[model samples]
Target: MKIQEIREIIKLMDQSTLDEFVFEAEGTKLKLKKHNGETRPTVHTSAQPQEQPAAVVTPKTDAPKVEAAPAEPIEKQESTSSEASSSYKTITSPMVGTFYSSSSPEADSYVKVGDRVNADTIVCIVEAMKLFNEIEAEIEGEIAEIHVKDGQLVEYGQPLFSIK
Candidate 1:
């Protein structure tokens, strides 16, 4: 997507009541959010084949964070997956929100390293706008790694777990 298009998206999101907006097409993922009444955007791209900026911004900084590192999962997760860890697939967040490893604080984590999971298994939860969204394994495998911690903020497309 062009910067103009992204700017337009920010404008639209700023005007709407929705606190967040996500757009993904081809190999690029764009996330925008309204926080404390401020409009912030995140950009995530992978080998797009199209010319685009590797705009990395942080919520605290004036950058997009590349999934805005809301995943900061964007930084470590990227390097974590790119180098020396190509054998496993990852479970990425479908939306931006707070990641919870269990149903509640007192509950046991949904899955841990070495745990086997089927495609439909609920491995975690992402809370967004007071909604608790169950994050499924989506792929059958044993949990190889947990990328994000419980109660941590995660951006769209940020990897939450690595499965082998």
Candidate 2:
């Protein structure tokens, strides 16, 4: 597989909620694991050419490898809950972007656990492209939990903050 193909697959994983991926061909095998950090940043290295590059072709694969894509973090513990009143509300993202807890790197988070919030209160920032969009709470409640972390890539309608 070409390097570009590998990068494309990685980008797809980051864009979606999917986590791990594996592919195996006759003798070539590929396994990708997403780390705990936010979306990967563009990395530049020395000894790289700065001129226009030619298009490369990738060969098709016929791998039958078993693949596992854990949606959530493997380190997160799961516990059963006696159904509450079912009165809790979920605040979802309005767009697909990088989720941020603060306006800048040096600023405090917009909202945190146990923080009292109401409608129209900015809860976080979802950066799409170069613009940082402020996400607001649509319901009144205390922040029960935050689903995504700072600099994390969030999908449209993804759960951001849970209210109760």
Candidate 3:
């Protein structure tokens, strides 16, 4: 019913496996829907804050149809991902957010390629809903690759690093 409550719900939804959420309380209806596997950057605008209102959904029957990716490319992607998983352990993002390599812009990166890390090592920060969460490398190994760059928007369960 409040803006903060709505934001919290959105954050939880982003971190979860659910793609759609709906709630009706006190004559007010709220619905949250997101297209999974389609990662898009969120653009924020500077404007005066306004009163909150229930979400409105409109059906778009005339929307253009999108063709799925070809089978060969999908197969190739699957093969590569499987190979990587087989050879290396991965550090994955637990929630969708903007990835930061350091605590701040002026600070050094938490870790780099060829750097060895333990299970408790903090590798990066993932900011979601104005909350910066420290991401840890859960496996002890050498950093084989960094999958994302600073300020990049990452999705839940997306690989952030490859460790050998």
Candidate 4:
């Protein structure tokens, strides 16, 4: 199928609130499905050439979760996933608020490139209302990448680590 025709069909779907489109033309059949604000394309072509374009649009569906890391590493971790070994310290929030790695816009971050931290170390700050509440590490480990940035709103259980 030509690229221009696919674009036009997608445009039509967005404008008309249509969720799925299927078309058959010149022994070639094409099906376009849109879900979770994303579009997926499927095409089927017959051996003999005939043009009979047809389009069908399906209903919207829920969005998939963020893609996970490869299965091999996760599988390795799964054997140890249930361990009582609290070797890594998780710096978590005390209250629901926005998380900030830096105190101010231009200041150095509370935790940086490779800082080691313990239970008492203030890793970052979670701002609730006008008050800034410092977040402390609950375990001991070298600093991994800070997941959220300064002034970024964080949900109660949002992850912020990749401890080794």
State which candidate has the highest lDDT.
Answer: 1
Higher-ranked by lDDT: 1 or 4: 1
What pairs collide in candidate 2? none
Which sections of candidate 2 miss by over 4 Å? 1-85
Off-target runs (Cα >4 Å) in candidate 4 are: 1-89
Best by TM-score: 1
lDDT of 3 by residue, 1-164 (tens): 54644666677666655445554434455666667532222322234432332223322245443333322211111224343567788788876699999999999999998999999999999998788888889799999888889999987568889888
Whole-model lDDT for model 2 versus the true structure? Answer: 0.65
The C-alpha lDDT values of all candidates are 0.74, 0.65, 0.69, 0.60
Candidate 3 residue 20 C-alpha distance from true site, Å = 12
RMSD, one per candidate, in order: 9.0, 15.5, 14.0, 17.3
- Structure candidate 3, residue pairs in collision: none
Residues 49-112, model 4: lDDT tens digits: 6543444445454543233222121111211334324564344444458888877878887778
TM-score of 3: 0.53
TM-score of each: 0.56, 0.50, 0.53, 0.43
Candidate 4 structure, TM-score to reference: 0.43
Cα lDDT, model 2, residue 134 = 85
